[model samples]
Target: MKNDFTLEVYSENAFSVLNRMINIFNRRRIRIRSLLATELEADYKHGMASFKLHTTAEQLERAMHQLEKLIEVERVVRIN
Candidate 1:
């Protein structure tokens, strides 16, 4: 089943983090439809990294798990 997820990533530079994310996606052989990482409007206390992704439910869950393992990643959620 296809699933759309909004994952809020807390990392330093969105650019570097995105590279790692892309590597993971390539390793997993999952194609990303669209991804956006924007700085949070709040202060630095919130960290500031957000992304939206569209993929299969299984792929999404697996990707989330992998992302959680990365030290740069603080948290992840499957938003509605």
Candidate 2:
């Protein structure tokens, strides 16, 4: 069975940050259903990225783990 997952990532607004996130999904051949990115605060350089993806629970967990390991990533949460 497949599960729908929403990942919220907080990180610096750097190209590398977005690249790393996309790479994680690409490496696993997972397609993102939707992606939204916005700046966290006007005074800060941090941003938030939200991604909706459909995949197995195991793959979701693995992706979450990899996201947390990135230096640019401050936090990661699964909305559903």
Candidate 3:
């Protein structure tokens, strides 16, 4: 079953990494409901990208795993 999710992805150069992460969802045919990307701190060395997605739990787990595999992605958190 599909459900709504709030996901936060922390990474380096969050803006740049957005494309790659979006591509993962695109390939899966999952639509992104909303997105917010910004540097986590003033240093710009780290960033956080938040997204609202509608998808099955299985797909969510797979996507999170793939996101973690990314070189720039520091971690992924499911807020809800």
Q: In model 3, which regions exceed 4 Å deviation?
A: none
Local distance difference test, each candidate: 0.67, 0.92, 0.91
> If ranked by TM-score, best first, what sequence of candidates would result?
2, 3, 1
Best candidate (score: lDDT): 2
- What shift in Å separates residue 6 of candidate 1 from its native position after superposition? 2.9
lDDT of 3: 0.91
Clashing pairs in 2: none
**Winner by TM-score between candidate 2 and candidate 1:** 2
Q: Write the per-residue lDDT of candidate 2 for residues 1-80, one digit (tens) a residue.
A: 67789999999888778989999999997779999988899866899999999898899999999999999999999999
- Summed backbone clashes in each candidate are 0, 0, 0
Ranking by lDDT: 2, 3, 1
| Residue pairs in clash, model 3 | none
Among all windows of 10 consecutive residues in model 2, the one with the lowest summed lDDT is 12-21
Poorest 10 consecutive residues by lDDT, candidate 1: 41-50
Query: Which has the better lDDT: candidate 1, or candidate 3?
Result: 3
